[model samples]
Target chain A: MVNTILIMAGVLMALGILLALFRFILGPDVTDRAIAFDVMTVSSISVIALIAYFAGRVIYLDVALVYGLLSFLSVVVIGRYIERGL
Target chain B: MEIRETVGAAVTLLGSVFIFLGGLGIVRMPDLFNRIQAGTKASTLGTILSLLGLAIMNEAWIWKLLVIIFFVLITNPISSNVISRAAHFRGTRMTNKTVADLLSDKNKKISEE
Candidate 1:
């Protein structure tokens, strides 16, 4: 049951990533692209965890954990650059 | 066992709805502020619940999931706020549907006077 639910999340996250990609491309400004990138990070995290469940591996959970941290760092760096670079 | 499975099923369904709402917000919201608020809140709730369901269904993964949740709780809103502030600073200009410009309007008044 968890596996099935994870798969559903994976599918939704994939769709969300694609939409975010569209935003990244079509966004009118750097900040818009940055927000889209942030969303993409989140969607990717959900997908990664779901795949871990599908494969029945605990190792991927660690990788997902790392990705979550990295995504946060990336967002912070980007945000700081945007705020202070002016 | 029955109750555990039932609770898992309910949470899973509700979590999916929240995730879907988060995704819809990302794709559909007309402005950055709206998208950030909707996307962050909905997805955070959704992912936390989903992680809880995973922990419940597969007990061994609970520790790792908890760690991931901790990271998520700290990062999600911070990123949203940072990006929204950046967008406001960059003068991205909101759609007509928006009712508030809490930060920008204040900045504008100060700069004007």
Candidate 2:
């Protein structure tokens, strides 16, 4: 039953990611593109966590965590650049 | 066979759904500010929830996941705020909305006075 639920969640996440791709192409500004990039980061993190669950490996969880933090930092840095009249 | 496990599973699943919706919002929204609003607040929280679900599944990795969540909570809003302010400062006007031009008009009035 838990596996069934995990699969369900994964499917939903997949659909969401596809929609985000749409925004990436359709967005009218640089900031919009950046937002789409951030969304993709979040989506990939979700996929990583689900993969960890299916694999039942402790290593993958930690990897996903690290990746999430790194992506968050990158977003911050990029945002800062934009804020500084870029 | 266990209720706790079921709860964990449910939380994780729900988190996944929310994260997905956040991504959808990113793609579907028309403007930069909208995407930033949707992506940062919604997706970050949703991702953290998903992390928590995984943490609950196992005991040894819970602490590490908490650290990641902490970082995400701190960074997401700050970054989005910075970007939105940049967008505004750079004069990326909303394409299809009517807003009273108070700032410019006030500047002009002050200049005249």
Candidate 3:
């Protein structure tokens, strides 16, 4: 049952990624792409957590945390650059 | 133990569904602010729930998961605010249906004095 649920969750997240990717590709603007990227990163973090669960390793949670921090930094930098001349 | 796994799986599934809805909003919303509002709220909740679910399933890793959750709770809104402000300053136009812009109005009021 746990395995089935995880598989279903993966499929749903995959569909989410596909929609976000569509927006990224069809971008009428750069901000749209940035938003899409943000969504993708968040979803990928969840995926990484799932991977950790599957592998029975506690280490990948650290990977997920780092990934989240880096993505947050990148998004903030992008927003700052877009807001001003940086 | 069995009950714990079942409950955790249900929560995780719900979180995944929310994340998917957030993606749909990001793609479907007509304006930048609208997209930001929709995507940020849903995704933030989705991420928190996902991590919480994971932590529930794996009791030993709860602290690390909580840290990740706390970080996400702090950063998601800040990033979204920055993005929306960038869009505003860059003169990203709203859809025709937008009735008012309080930020611009406040700025105008301050500049007048």
DockQ of each: 0.52, 0.67, 0.84
User: Model 2 over residues A1-86: C-alpha lDDT tens digits?
Assistant: 87787788788878877777787787777777677777777667768877976887768867766777787787767777777734
A51 in model 2: Cα distance from truth in Å?
A: 1.5
Compose the digit string of candidate 2's lDDT tens values, residues B21-65.
Answer: 787677656566666776667778777887788677665778877
Off by over 4 Å in 2: B98-113
Candidate 1 lDDT, B1-113, residue by residue in tens: 75675566456556656776776776788878777877778878877887777677677778888999888888898888888777777788788987776777788899999
- Interface Cα RMSD per model, in Å? 2.2, 1.8, 0.9
TM values, all candidates: 0.86, 0.84, 0.95
Question: Model 3 in CAPRI terms: which quality?
Answer: high
lDDT values for all models: 0.75, 0.74, 0.87
As for candidate 1, its interface RMSD to one decimal place is: 2.2
Supply the TM-score of chain A against the true chain A for every candidate structure: 0.85, 0.85, 0.96
Candidate 1 stretches greater than 4 Å from native: A1-5, B1-10
Residue A46 of model 3 has an lDDT of: 88
